[model samples]
Target: MKKKKISLGDWIFNIFLGLFFTLFTLICIYPFYYLIINTISANDISANGQIMFLPKGIHFQNYIDVFKIPDLASAALVSLGRTVLGTIGAVLGAAYLGFMFTQQKMWARKFWYRFTIITMYFNAGLIPWYITMRNLHLTNNFLAYILPAIVQPFNIILVKTYMESISPALQEAAEIDGASVMKVFMKIMLPLAKPIMATIAIFAAVGQWNSFQDTLILMTKPALYTLQFLLYQYINQASSLAAMIKNGTVISTSSLATMQTPTSIRMTVSVVVILPILLVYPFFQKYFVKGIMIGSVKG
Candidate 1:
């Protein structure tokens, strides 16, 4: 069959939509591109804000300076450990809860779901949360970061949506074969829901990896600082260190002198901190897209 010819109005509308989306995409990506360029550029050029789309001069000194900072590597390891454990726990717990809520016979399911939903909008204020954490002896503990955010309501909601989309015939078949609810969930549903699980896992992983506020509030020891908290301290305190060096209070050798260029150092730290998430995202992109499309269609 011959294809229908495109009309002038359709062509005009398509051109307008393309230009609008292209402009939106550029606006979204320019900042990250600028950041990557500025991070590798010399600090002198970055400080002047002249490095926009490209670096004025190439430099790896910022990365070397970041390495020189004491406890950087150790703090990164601590953050990595916390992120891995917390993300796993969150994904598993949320998935189980989602599966449970998907069952028609689950008692008080509406009330429980409402309770979880309420948490999404309403939170106990910082002071009350801090007091509770202190009372529970979670302060200064790694659990302080991991436990509080383990079962986010948004993730639970996503999992529940995905789980509900599974055909009821599957569960009925499992039950007919003498499988209990737990066995059915573990053996059948969980395996089939890998796409949604992976999507949720990526979200949980990125959130935990970038978390800094919880560590700042719950952890007092410098040794327990997450990558983000360490970077925050570095950014906030670097100027004071630079001033000390200028006043001769702190001696600045060639290695130590690089501390003064924290503009580039901060950018480099951001790039480094975000690199893992960037690398992991492409692996999950297909799963994420599938999960979203499935949920949207089913809904």
Candidate 2:
């Protein structure tokens, strides 16, 4: 094939596009760069409110201090558990529900499907949701993190619609071989549905990991607190940090002074909270795109 020459208009458009994207990319990167710089810099550099396009007087004490915070380890464990279990539960539950919704054996599928769709558009207010969870005795329990999020209507619908696009003959053949619905789902459908499930898993994990509101509302016990809520308390409640300083670990008055005047350790906490998701995202990104695009266009 002969190469086509680019028109002057196309050249101009490409230049503009490149410039726009460069600016956008810088905008996105700036915050993380600032956080890293502030996190690594010495207390004096950070306290001076220096313009930090680049790091100054680098040190790692901020991260050390963040680690030294009280219950941070336990809270991290809770967050990690919630992310893993909640993601698996939500994805598998959605997949199973999606599979069942397509089955002839499911009773009142139309009514239930419509009802699920309706719930998406209309929500009972937060007060009712809070009261309902309270009445159900979910408060101060780890179950609060995973159970409430397991049934994601949007995800179920995506999986269901994608499943519908699978050849009916495969299902019929399995049924003819005396393979039960559960067996077929476990052996066949799930394996074939990996791409979409990966996509939903990312969504579910990020949501569960970053869920601060639920912890704040549902948990009163310190032991039940998630990393997100712990960080939130550190930000909003000075007394909380003061308590941590008294009990968690000892830091110098100068370290404490930086927080009071200029430098904020909360930036380090933000980086810690976000770092895992950032690291994990690239692995799922392809699947996320593939799942949404294919699931949308075909099914």
Residue 78, candidate 1: C-alpha displacement in angstroms: 1.2
Best by TM-score: 1
The lDDT per prediction is 0.82, 0.83
lDDT of 1 by residue, 1-299 (tens): 99999999999999999999999999997877888888777665676788887776676777776777789888889889888898888888888988898988999999998898789899889999999999999998988877876788887888888888889899999899999999999999889888888888888888889989988888889888888888887788768755665688755353342344556656777887888898889988999999767655542
lDDT of 1 at 228: 86
| Candidate 2 local lDDT, 40-123, one digit each (tens) | 776556656784787766767767766777999899999999999999999999999889989977899888877876888899
TM-score, candidate 2, is 0.83
> TM-score of the candidate numbered 1?
0.84
Alpha-carbon shift of residue 41 in model 1 (angstroms): 1.8
Model 1 scores a C-alpha lDDT of: 0.82
Candidate 1: stretches off by over 4 Å: 1-29, 241-259, 296-299
Residue 285 in model 1: shift from native, Å? 0.6
Worst 10 residues of 1 by lDDT: 252-261
